[model samples]
Target: MFTDGRLLSDPGPILARVRHRGSPRAFVFAGVQRVPVVSEEVGQALKTLAPGDVQLFPVSVEDVDERFFIVNVVRVVDCIDEAGSTGVQHYAEDDPFPERAGEFRWISGLRILPEKTEGARAFMLKRFKHPIIVAEEVKEALERIGNLGVMFKRVTGNPGA
Candidate 1:
């Protein structure tokens, strides 16, 4: 639902079933698709840091009564500095999905115009919702939680470095 950047009317009961038994972290991608899921602690931090940038929906994980929420980052900023970025590829006209010709196929070492973000703390890059971009404050908050299953990459400074 979040991939489209639209507000959900009623997401219904979201269930994240556990496929493997292990200790869960404060944050973790739901599956191979990398859907962002957060524990109550992490969710509270996000709620405080970016109350307007995200919508948290309660989720039920298989066999675990612990509270969790599926993080739906609603903001999609079109601020990618394409020229300053490297290893960026857009779908070409000859590609199978011709409609996506101008859309990002993949991006490595991504860079964005911080000013163009319009002060959004947590957001997804327009046309490339796979990666979530969070401000330093948010990162710090997540780090403070300590048990993160996510990794961070700097996206706004020293492009091409």
Candidate 2:
């Protein structure tokens, strides 16, 4: 999510629009600006499962009666094991956003220092917010709910030599 807590502070009404409607509905999907929109069930589960790691704000989706929420995964941790990762790149000095020159632009074969996660079940990388990292337990819990529009990549297990 791109929100930096400003969304939490803003007291304005929140509205959303679904571009399509079909079966196998996604319980968690990208809303406007890539913000996470989740079903009330998913939202409540997250609130109980990772209360300290996320914040949920109610949202009104066009023509839908079921409650939905915008999930803001609040915790940001600098735990990327850069030395252990592969295909990693940073924003270039000549890029448009020079201030982000040294920040992560892309990362494959992601690895993280488990010890540095601060016991958070869900968190985003300090400089990279594209993926929301969740602990194994959290992953299992979400999986149990089904209809998730996301996938998991193992970044904490042993690397085969």
Candidate 3:
């Protein structure tokens, strides 16, 4: 996994390549830019972050199928154990939800639905929250997989293929 601030700046190029192939489907951000924190541990792996870093993890569509349809895993770091320590907390301390740490709070999976498959589509649509920044690279990878399926069907002389 490539880790650095440059990943965020031009994720477009990396994403584009991923879209073309059905490999390296996952992408993760190691820091949350514009956030602040007291120690550097939070920003070590990530770049251009605020106070802390945010990581990204990406999974390929093909891998999901091979693994029983599990797509992605997202882990957010935003918890502090304040054992009665009266330390000065920054203004941005309240920005991240401390209640949830080491938890997969974001999108975790994506499944392919057959065309016109209302039941399947409905389920995915509900699971995927709106306003999601579905990167172009991800979209491209999925599209490539779709095209492969179509090709297989035509060649095998079976729509199910």
Candidate 4:
């Protein structure tokens, strides 16, 4: 979060570290998916949210892998901006171009730190070579999901605790 306490989860920088920081490093996929689009059942299963708000479906990444962390995906917005390009997708099926693919959803997730650990401190101190842009709605949803994670941590001693 910024100093004003707006939550954020910018995957780009952390991912860059995984790729460029470690020695003897092998490239790993962040495991993007969109096999089943959000249906009525899925929407209802998640909460009282409307089906239309759920542009991305639930992905199962529920294990402690050496290289992966289970990040909560809160929202996926249609990138109509990237319309005319070729649809070489990572999350969606063969559909990178929104014009041809119907809608391209960019993944945004929840992030938090209890009190800036060593890793968090290192991450914050790192310099960024490029601008990592995420959508506004996606950021808001991530903040909401992050608040839920914080609540869960307090109650159940789960995530972020």
Each model's total of backbone clashes: 0, 0, 24, 1
Clashing residue pairs, candidate 4? 87-96
Per-residue error for 4 in candidate 1, Å, reads 1.9
lDDT string for model 4 (4-99, tens) is: 112344434232122233332111223232112222232233333322222222332223223322222233222222223233233344655434
Model 3, 1-161: lDDT tens per residue?
22112124322221111134443322212123211111122122222222122333222233233211111112221221223212313323244865433322332222222332232101112222211122233334434434222111111112243
Q: lDDT of each structure?
A: 0.87, 0.79, 0.24, 0.26
Best by the lDDT measure: 1
TM-score of every candidate relative to the true structure: 0.93, 0.88, 0.18, 0.19
Residue pair clashes in candidate 1: none
Ranking of all predicted structures according to TM-score, beginning with the best and ending with the worst: 1, 2, 4, 3
Residues 68-109, candidate 2: write the lDDT tens digits.
888888888899999998889999999998989889999988
Candidate 1 vs candidate 2: the TM-score winner is 1
Point out the worst 10-residue segment of candidate 4 by lDDT.
121-130
TM-score of 2: 0.88
Query: CA shift at 52, candidate 4, in angstroms?
Result: 2.7
Candidate 2 regions off by >4 Å?
A: 5-7, 24-26, 159-161
Candidate 4 residue runs with Cα over 4 Å from true position: 1-29, 32-47, 53-59, 62-141, 147-161
Q: Write the per-residue lDDT of candidate 1 for residues 28-145, one digit (tens) a residue.
A: 8877777789999999999899988988899999888899998888888999999878889899999999988889999987899999998999998887767899999999989998
Q: How does candidate 4 score on lDDT?
A: 0.26
Model 3 per-residue lDDT at 132: 19
TM-score between model 3 and native: 0.18
